[model samples]
Target: MADDDDEGGFGGLYEDGHWIWDDISKSLVFVSDLPPKPVEAIQILAKAPTGTVEFRDDVDLIEQIRFRRRYQRKLKPGQEDVITVQDVKDIALYTAPVQIMSPLLINMLHLPTTERFIRALILYSAYYLQIADEMANRIMELEKKIRTPDCDILEHEFRDNLADLRLLVAKEYSVMLIGGSDMRKFHHMGPAKKRRSLSDKDARLFETLLRMCVQIVWLALGRKSFNQIELETNRIFKSEIFNAVEHTLKTGYINNMAKEERVVLLGHCLRYDKKLNTRSPLMNEVFCHRPIDYRMMGLGVIKVQQMSPRLHYMLQAVAGPEEKLSELGVVVGILGMPRSAFDTMLRPLPTAVEKSKASMSSTSGHSSSKSTASMGKSTTAAHKVYPDVVLPRKETRELFYPPSFPDEPEKIRPCSETQRRRWQNRLMKLLHPHR
Candidate 1:
């Protein structure tokens, strides 16, 4: 490996040719596609007099532009290609992250809904799904340019199928049961009489759907789950959210947060559950700062959980079970009840009418009126807008844990003694001057 040799010292291919690892060319690399890609980073060899190497916006000149990929995990002996945790986890150079928290978080840590997630829309909704579709396609083209030995490529492979995935998820939760003349016809019949709606159950289930969507989107964006983080992290996220809410309730101020803030908080909260040490302010902002996303509708519906006595009685004021319910009708608003109570109430009643109505447009009622930048796309808005139980699947594909029930918990484990000494020396280098 001579210095002048440009043949094989980690030379990666590019449109112009190949770039040797040690080659100090005056070039910059721009990394974008913020979401879902763990390392949405930009770096370049700054040819300035200082000759610094750092993030740059130029694509052509940059020497390296590796994407955070999601591909298959490597397996153990006799298990070639078997997906292991390392193959999935190691797929990061760097990327933006949001904090996530779920009481159900630990229970279903390994198998979050990401595998079965469907964020789709119809072809007619050109403006909405078109750009998304193009983005997905462009990602595929870029993927071919580079190949890492790890697994983030799997997530990259998912880019093209975003639209159809949503459709498939809708079909999974379609929950339509029909027989007789209604079922026999080639032509379609009307919606089911008894179906999921706000009033059919308590607000929690409705809210859970919203929470799940946010969690899913957050997960898709590669953020760590909050409950899975330190117990303190979870506390911080909730505290921040509540504090922000309190500010709004008491005074009038706005606090907005980024995806990173969420992840940091969740991580911090879980970091010191035993001690409850000082929390990260970033988490405070996220929990409280209202992200004006379509998920808000689901959040609002979920908000039914916090309903004052007046709101609860108001729901009861609605007409009898036989009455026709409008979109925001009582049936759609019963999101606060506990699952058992909600289910018990619906044991006899009919489900929401599963009308094959054309999809709702412009808004899915999940978004808050205040924010323009909402959840993933329009389709997810309507998907969770209508009430549904959306229980966690039995066989979740998440690599870390199983679905619903977790097996033995595994600690991340400490670095070895030799590795610890090397780590300490490195840390000391930045903090302490030479002897």
Candidate 2:
């Protein structure tokens, strides 16, 4: 509180480093030796603006120059982080879910294999469109900095092209797996042996196209991880089918076209199933056996359920059982025999085999002594390529349902009561055939 003096409305009220000079309202002024800390400055460039100059101190000038240089460096060719290895490792994105309709699509969905390919083609197109749209959007944003109007026309064109592509692919695929002599072959073949009927060249070509589509989809969508795809490719390459193909190719036994057309179809199926869907069917969990006479195996030579009917019959004649006997009646039963006939045929074989087992075991012991000698001698080649089944494990790791991902510990899919009972019945039939 202050009382007014003779000549003063209010004399300057001096405190620590400031003086209050105003009377109606208090205002303080201060002076200090320490200079204020420099704050970082940001400046936005104008769109299509005439060149303008700004005045700034040494620090601000240096900061602006450095920012400009960094921006310029980013615009340089081959400097994009998106295409770099380190960025790929860090980002690790891939294409999303796709249902790889089995090659047996005709049997399973009553849809042609070409229809499934078209679906996959649509997925690939989706990926391509997404990438194009993203790039277009980025360009639009960048162009906005240079020119204010939006790229509405470009956006519209992209959308139209995408729609047209989908429609065109769908329409074209409708006729691809049907009609013509070449196409009729595909339709007439058994669902299980469709791919087998193809010349190696055709198969490989189809596989290559599928592989490319899958690869592109993954690169664009970033759904699955890179490691999963790589492992799948490696597994495919190491398969017996690949080996057989390679062996024949090297020997010139397989034509160049057939050699090129590979069985990468199953690999893709496995990839889509395991990496994308939990309910993926066990496509590769199939068994094919051939009985041979040489190894003291009680059943004489026989070939079972081969992909090629011609090859199956050929091998049967050359190496199959001399006597025409239904070994376990499995083949005949599987061929849709009458239930009563199947039951009647199934009995007594096990007892008969049991009685012969003791003699076979003693002979098998003798054969084991000569196993090393037999190992060097080549047995007739009856190769049944089950790509998903590893040789070391006779059975699949996932019995009823495929795992959605490799890391998934649970092997079984959650099923309805009916499905669970159906699986139980099948398992019982398989494991305890006598029952």
Candidate 2 structure quality by residue, lDDT tens digits, 1-435: 355453656756556544555654565455554668985232222221110211111235454454334211132364322121111111111111112212222121122233233333323233222323243334435545653345444444443333322323333233343423124444433333444343443343334333433343333222232222322232333333333333432433112112111121121122233333322111221111222111111111122221233223222222232122123211210111121221111212344434434544543322111101111221111110000100011122322332431231212212123322333343345446898
User: What would the TM-scores of all predictions be?
Assistant: 0.19, 0.18
Candidate 1 overall lDDT versus native: 0.25
lDDT of 2: 0.28
Winning candidate number (lDDT)? 2
lDDT of each: 0.25, 0.28
